[model samples]
Target: MRIYAVINQKGGVGKTTIDVNLGYGLAKSGKRVLLIDLDPQGHSTTVLGDQGAELTVKELFESGSKLGIKELAQPARVHGEVVENLDIVPSNIKLAVSAENLAARIHREKVLANALEKVKGDYDICLIDCPPTLGVLAVNGIFAADRFLIPVTYARYALDGVADLFGIISTVRETDEFNYTIIRNGYDSRTKTTNDFIEGQLEPFAANVAKTRIRKTETINQAAINAEPVFTFDAKGNGTADFEALTKEVVGLDA
Candidate 1:
C-alpha cells in the first residue's frame, strides 16, 4: 500500500478537508482507503461520522501497545451509513498527551511505520491526517508516509514555515526518492492580484504544484457540518469537481 500524509505546519490550510475528501473520493472509485487521524484534535475522525472510538490512533503511539491498525480501524460512516471501501483510525484529544509521552520512547519516529508493516496489503492507500505542527506525532506520520500532500491557502502567509517542514523531511529521509505535491486550497479566482502573488511565491515549487485548485466554496463547509463528503453532500457541487480532479492527479503520481 502507498501511504500519503496530508500535512502542513500552518493551520487552517485545509489539511483535514483534503485528507477526508480525497480518501473518500478514492474509496468511491474502487480503491481501498485507510485514513489515520493523527491529529490530536480529531477533526478527521469527527468528519468521518465517528465519535468516541474505543481504540484509536492514540494507542499506536503509546509504548508497548499491542493494538494493530486492523483493530483500530473502523468503517467510515456518513449520516449513519457506512462508506464502502473506506476505513478510519479515529483520534481524540488525549492524543496530545500520548504524543508527549512518545518523545521518550526508543525509535519513536518509526513506531507508526512499524505498525503499518503488518497491514500493508490490506488497503490500496493509507492517508494520514497529521497535526499542524512539527511535533513527535507529525514526525511519526512523516516517517510512515511514502508521499506527502501539502495543502496551501491563498493567503500571503500560506507558505510560512513550509521551509522548516521541508527541512525536517529532508533530515528524516536524507534522500530524494520520496515525492511531494503542493495543492492550493481555498482558492479564489476573483482576486487576481492575490492569486498572482501566491502563484509567484509558488514558483520555486512549481514542479510539485498540483494543476487542480480546490476553489473556495461554502458547500465544503456545509458538507463538513453535516458529517459527509461532497460526493454525498452535493454530487454536482464545485467542491466535488475539484476533489475529483485532485484524486485523479494524486493517483497518477508515482509514490
Candidate 2:
C-alpha cells in the first residue's frame, strides 16, 4: 500500500480537505482507500461522512496491536452506497490526551507504523490526516508514512513552518527514502499575491511542487457542508477537476 500523510504544521492550509478529497478521488477510481484521521480535531472524519464512530485511531495507539484494523476502521459511505470502497479510522478529542503517553512508550514513534502494518495489505492507498503541529502525534505520523503530501496556501509567509516539518523528516528518517510533494491549495490566479508566492516563495522548491494547484472555489466549501467529496457533490465543478488531476499526479509519481 502507498501510505501518504497529508500534513502541515501551520493550520488552515487545507490538510483535511486534501486528505478527504484525495482519498475519495482514489476510491471513486476503484482503488481501496483507507483514511486515518490522526487529527484530534476530527475534521477529516466528519467530512468523509462518518460521525459518532464507536472506534477511533486513538485506540490503536492506546491498545497497540490489540485493536486490529477491522475493529477500528469504519466504512466511508454516503446515503448507503452512494460512495464506496473507502474506510476511515476516525479520530476524537481523546487523541490529544493519548499523544502525551506516546512519548513515554518504547519506540513510540513507530506505534502508528506498527498499527498500520496489520491493515496495509487490505487497501491500495492510505491517507493519514496529521495534527497541525510537530508533536509526538505528528512524529508518529511521519514514521508511518511512505511519503508526505504538503498543502500550502498562497500567503506572504506561506513557507514559514515548512522548515520545522523538514527538520522532523530529516531527524527521523532518510530524507531521500520518502518523497515529498507540495501542492498549492486555495490558489487564485487572478490575485497578484498568489502569483508572487508561486514565483518568490515556492519557486525555490519547484522540483517538489505538484504542477496542479487546487484553485479557490466555493464548491469545496459546499462539498464540506454537504458531507461529501467535491467529485460526488459537484462533479462538474473546478474543485473536482483539480483534485482528479492531483490524484493522477500522485499515482504517476508512485509509478
Candidate 3:
C-alpha cells in the first residue's frame, strides 16, 4: 500500500479535516482508501460521524496480530454502501492514556509499523491522521508510513515549534523511516500574516510542500461541525474542489 500519514506537530492545522475530506475525495475518484485516526482526539472519527466506533486504534494496538487489520477496519461514518472503497480505523480520548501507558513498554515506536505490516497491501493508499505530538506513538506512526504530509496553519506559530516539526522529520529520516511531503493548510492570503508566511517563508519550502492549499473557508468549518466530509456535505463547494485537486496530486504521485 502507498501509506501517507497526514501529520503535523501542531494542532488545529486541519489535519483531521484534510484526512477525512481527502480520503473521501480520493475514494470518490475510485481509489481504495484507508484512513486511520491516530489522533486521540478522534476528530476524524467524530467528523466522519462514527458515533459507534466499534474498534479503535487502541484496540488495534493492543490487538497486535490477533485482530488483524482487515477486520480491524470499519466503514467510516460518512462511508456506507455508497463509498465502499473508503475505510477508517477510528480513535478516542482513551488513546491519549493508552499512548502514555504504551510508552513504558518495549517496541513502543515499532508497534504501529508492525501492526500495519499485517495488512501491507490491502489498500491502494493508507492515510493516517497523526496526533500533534512527537510521542512514541507519533514516531511509530511515521515509522509505519511510507510517505506523509505535514499540515501547517497560516498564523503566528512559535517558529521554534515549526522547526521542531522538521526536526522530528529529520530524525525519522536519520532512521530511514519514511520520506514525506509538507502541506500548507488554512492559508488565508487576505491576512497580512498569512500572506507573509506563505510568501516570505513557506514559498521557499515548496519542494517539500503540496501544490495546493486548503484556503480558509466556512464550508470546511461547517463540514466539520456537521460531522461529515465536505465531499459528502457540499461536493460542489470550493473546499471540495481543492481537496479534489489534492486527491489528484496524491494519485499522480507514483504513476
Candidate 4:
C-alpha cells in the first residue's frame, strides 16, 4: 500500500480536510483507503463522524502490533451507510498521552512504522492526518509514510514552518525518501495578494505544488458540518471535484 502523510506544522491549513476527502475520493474510485488520525485533537474522527470505536490509534500505539490495525480500524460512513473501501483508525485526546510516552521509549520514531507494516497490504492507500506541530507524533507519521503532502494556505505566513518540517523529515529518512507535494489550500482567486504570494513566494516549489488548488468555499465547511464527504453531500460541487483531481494526481505518482 502507498502511505502518505498529510502534514503541516501550522494549524488551519486544511490538512485534516484533505485527508478525509482524499480517502473518500480514492475509495469512490474503487481503491481501498485507510485514513489514520494521528492528531490527538481527533478532528478527522469528528469530520468523518466516526464515534464509539473501542480501539483508537491511542490503544493501537500502546498495544503495538498485538492489536492488529484491521481490528483497530472502523468503517468511515456517509449517509448512514459505510462508504465502500474506506476505513479510519480514529484518534482521541488520549493520543497525546500515548505520544508523550512514546517519546521516552526505545525505537520511538519507528513505532508507527512497525505498527503499520503488519497491515500495510490490506489497503491501496493510507493517509495519515498529522498534528499541527513537529512533535513525536508527527515524527512517527513521517517515518511511516512513503510520501508527504504539505498543505499551504494562501497567506504568506503559512510558509513560516515549511523549513522546520523539511528539516525534520530529512533527518528521519534519505533525501530521496523526502518525496513530497505542496497543495495550495484556502485559495482565493480574486485576491491580488494571493496571486502575488503564489507567484513570488511559492514559485520556487512550483513543481511540488498541486495542479488543482483547493479554493475557499462554504460548501467545504457545509459538508464537514454535515459529517459527510463532499461527494456524498454535493456530488457536483467544486469541493468534490477538487479532491477528486487531487486523488488522481496522488494516485498517479508512484510510491
Candidate 5:
C-alpha cells in the first residue's frame, strides 16, 4: 500500500481537512483507504464521525502495546452511518502524553512504519494526518509514509517552516524515492494580489505544487460541521469537485 502523510508544521493550513476529504474521496472511487489520526487534538477522528474510540493510534507508539492497525482501525462513519471502504485509526488528547513518552524509546520513529508493515496488504492507500509540530509523533508519521502531502494556505507565511520539514525528511529517509506534493487549500483566485504574493513565495517549489487549487468554499466547513465528507454533504458543490480532482491527481489519473 502507498502511504501518504498529510503534514505541515504550520497549523490551520487544512491538513486534517485535506486528509479526511481525500481519504473519503479515494474510498468513493473504489479504493480501500486507511486513515491514521496522529494528532493529539483528534480532529480527523471527530471529522470522520468517530469520537472516543476504544482503541486509537496511541497504542501503536506505546511501549509493549501489541495492538496493531487491524485492531485499532474501525469502519469510518458519517452521521452514524458506516462509510464503505474507508477505515480510521482514531486519536484522542491522551496521544499528547504518548508522544512525550515515545521520545525516550529506541527506534521510536520506526514504530509506526513497523506496525504499518503488518497491514500493508489490507489497504490500497494509507493517509496519516500528522499533528502541527515537528515532534516525535510527526517524525514517526514521516518515517512511515512513502510520500508526503503538504497543504499550504493562502497566507503570506504559508511556506514558513516547510524548508525545515523537508530537511528533516532528507535526514531521516536519505533517498530520492521519497517525494512530496504541495496543494494550495482555501485558495481565492479573486484576490489577485494575495494569490500573486503566495505564488511568488512558492516559486522555488512551483514544480511540486498541485494543479488542483481547492477553492475557498463554505460547503467544506458545513460538511465538517455535519461530520461528513463533501461527497455526502454536497456532491455537486465545488468542494466535492475540487477534492475529486485532487484524488485523481494523487492517483495519477490527472497526470
Candidate 6:
C-alpha cells in the first residue's frame, strides 16, 4: 500500500486537519484509507470521532507483534456513512513515553513499519499523522512510510521548518526511505504573508506542491469541532474544493 506521512516539525500548520480531511477525501474516492495517529496528542483520535479509542500507540509498541490493526484501529469519527471506507489507529500522550522506552534498540526504527505490515494490504493508502517534533517516534514514522506529504501553514515562520524536516528525510533515505511530496495546507490568497511564503520560501523545498491551496475557512474549522470533514459538513465550501483538487493530484482520480 502507498503510505503518506503528514508531517512538519513545526505545529499550528493544520497538519491534523490535512491528515483527517485528506484521508476522508481519499475514502470518498472509494479508496480504503487507513489513518494512523503517530502524534502523542491524540488529536487524530479525537478528530476521528472515536471517543474512547482508548488504545494509544504506546500500548502497541509495548505489546509488540501481538497487536493487530483491527485491535488498534477505530473507524474514523464522521457522521453518516461518509467514513465507511476510513479507519484509524488512534494515539495519545503516552506515545512519547513509548518512544523513550524503545529508543535504545536500533531495531526501533522498524517497529512501526513492522506493525503496519500486518494490515497494509487492506488499504489503498495509509496516512500517518506525525507529531510536531523530530523525535524518535517521528523517526520511526518516517522510516515506516512510503512517502512524505508536508502541510505548511500560511504564516511567516513556516519557511523556517524545511531544513529540519529535510535533514530527517536525508537520514531516513540513507536507509530504505520512501519518496516524498510536499503540499501547501492552509492558504489564504488575501494574505501577503501567505504569498511571501509560497513564492519566496516553500517553492524551493516542496517536492510535490499541489496546484490548490487549502483556504482559511470557518466551515473547515467548524467541521473539525463537529468531528467531521468539510466535504461531509459543507461540500460546497472552498475547503472541500481544495482538498478534492488535492486528492486528484494525489491519486490521479476524478473523485
- Residue by residue across 71-99, what tens digits does model 6's lDDT show? 88777766534368898887877777887
Native-to-model Cα distance after best TM-score fit, residue 46 in candidate 1, in Å: 0.4
**TM-score of each model, paired residue for residue:** 0.97, 0.94, 0.90, 0.95, 0.96, 0.90
- Lowest lDDT 10-residue stretch of candidate 4: 59-68
Q: Which regions in candidate 5 have their CA more than 4 angstroms from the true location?
A: 175-177, 253-255
Clashes of each: 0, 0, 0, 0, 0, 2
User: Any runs in candidate 2 off by more than 4 Å, and if so which?
Assistant: 63-65, 79-82, 174-177
Lowest-sum lDDT 10-residue window in model 1: 170-179
lDDT of 5 at 231: 85
lDDT of 4 by residue, 136-227 (tens): 89989999988899998888688988988898899877564568899888878789876786658877888888898887888998988887
Query: What would the per-residue lDDT of candidate 3 be over residues 72-149, giving only the tens digit for each residue?
Result: 688765644346688888788878877877878776777777777878777788888888889876888877777878
Cα lDDT for residue 79, candidate 3: 42
Q: Which should have the higher TM-score, number 4 or number 6?
A: 4
Q: What is the lDDT of residue 52 in candidate 5?
A: 82
Q: Which 10-residue span in candidate 2 carries the lowest summed lDDT?
A: 75-84
Clashing pairs in 1: none
Q: How many backbone clashes does candidate 4 have?
A: 0
Q: Which digits, one per residue and each the tens of the lDDT, describe model 2 over residues 143-228?
A: 98888999988877777889888988878876645689998999887898667855687777889899999999999988888877
What is candidate 5's CA lDDT for residue 221?
A: 88
The candidate scoring highest on lDDT is: 1
30-117, model 5: which lDDT tens digit per residue? 9999999999999989978466877888999889998999899999998778999999999999999999999999998999999999
Better of 2 and 5 by TM-score: 5
Angstrom error of the Cα, residue 234, model 5: value is 1.3
Kindly report which residue stretches of model 6 are placed more than 4 angstroms away from their true locations once superposed.
49-51, 63-65, 79-82, 175-178, 253-255
| Candidate 5 clashing pairs, residues 3+ apart or interchain | none
